[model samples]
Target: MIPSLRLLYWRPSAAALVRTRALLPMAEFYNHETGDGAFRLIQKSDYARALQGARVGLCLSDHEGPMRASVEYQLLDLPVVTTEAQGGRIEMMDPAHCRVVPADPRAVADAVQELAAEEIPAGAVRASVLSRLAAHRAALPGLIRPHLQAAFDDASAGVTLDDIGKVDLWRTRDAEVIRREVDAMPV
Candidate 1:
């Protein structure tokens, strides 16, 4: 943890670990337990308020599914210090406002400090996410058009594998599988 920084750990489980293990000593060293200094324990529900007050958001989990919290933080225009383990968060994050580091506290703290020192515009961060989402939405039809066309043509012709072009063979197999599954279902 950075000496000048105040970190709020929002996960109850992480607080429990700090209380039960060798981490407690480290927390004490940082004056985390006294609630008077560099570290504090907070509830997840307070995230919106916390992000508003905080200079950086930290996502340190080594394993995660979607990490919506990190995205929310970015949407709120806060810079994020995330572990490399972040899966979905990495995709939407702008490098100027986000740093992907190892799961070490020192690295996280350093990233936080670095980001804090920079002049990242909150509107830019929010715009990056919005633009990415809009691009994805715009591309949705392109992604599904071929499949929809294949389905429509297949329904009309009662498609056979031989009738499908090489590029669309996967769709032909998928249609066959669906047909087999439907035919096997009871009336």
Candidate 2:
């Protein structure tokens, strides 16, 4: 049986068209275009409902920050086929539930086929996201504490309000200054 696929396009950009064209020959293409301008926005509930019968979610973007849609796909119990350059998504997904492939369309097609043949439990996929979220929450304070301390120390230092007024905020807030401050913090 042919596996069901759901392609979620947030904006009607050239990128979306490229992805759709790449996958069209591999499977039957369906167009559900709505809305106007570049955006084809859908409600979260509607998106989730649309994913109900999908066997896999495809994220074919060349780059992504966190790949929020892929995470949503996992939450809705759909396996994800994403690109490796998808930022935090690589770290968020478990290998069992997510396939990180190259940007090549063939690679994406192969991953989809592989995932379609296997049975991935929905609860396990959702649990992977929850576990990552819990770990991130637990570690957030530690990651942020040093920066907060550095900012506090800077505020209390010999620099007076008058001196602060004279100083260029942009230059003072450069990456090198921040890096030096972070590096100086005690482990």
Candidate 3:
């Protein structure tokens, strides 16, 4: 745990650990090392609660469809620093609330610092995201209506995994044995 929480660098999915790891140095620099500049990878839903005391958010993805995590930050009115995304995610970001920076520790750290200092209103950022989502939400019925019956009536196929393939691959290391090392964790 960071002694003082200033930034919340969220890994949108468990597989996205690398992106956050590369930038841990930035978290360390800003959080001043008592136990902070944190990263989250739990398969849990209380993500918003983790942002209770954070000042800025970091969402730097190389490719994403809509990048909901970045928008979540906006919904909470937390300023964000992000890299250019490949899947039209930037279209939903608020230009005044977010800074499109490179995926560098120094640049991101500076952006975090700059964003934290600015007095941006919560409503403005939230409105920016909502307004953009309006179009997608409005079109949702039309898109789903045609498939609604099939979606509800079709018999869904069960998941099939190759016996040799890894299970829980999202949170495992290569060739690592699966063990519950509860004793290794901090109290």
Candidate 1 lDDT, 22-89, residue by residue in tens: 55343322224435643465545554655566677778787886677677877788888899983567
Q: Considering lDDT, where higher is better, how would the candidates rank from best to worst?
A: 2, 1, 3
Candidate 3: misplaced stretches above 4 Å?
1-45, 139-187
Error of 3 at 1 (Å): 18
The lDDT, on a scale of 0 to 1, for candidate 3 is 0.60
TM-score, every prediction: 0.58, 0.67, 0.54
Question: Ten consecutive residues with minimal summed lDDT in candidate 3?
Answer: 155-164
Please give, for residues 9-116, the per-residue lDDT of candidate 2 as tens digits: 655557767776685645523334444323455676777766677878887777777778778877877778888783577777889878989978678888989987
Q: Pick the candidate with the highest lDDT.
A: 2
Full-model lDDT for every candidate: 0.66, 0.69, 0.60
What's the lDDT for candidate 1? 0.66
Q: Which residue pairs does candidate 3 place in steric collision? A: 1-35, 2-35, 2-36
How high is the lDDT of residue 31 in model 1?
Answer: 26
Clashing pairs in 1: none
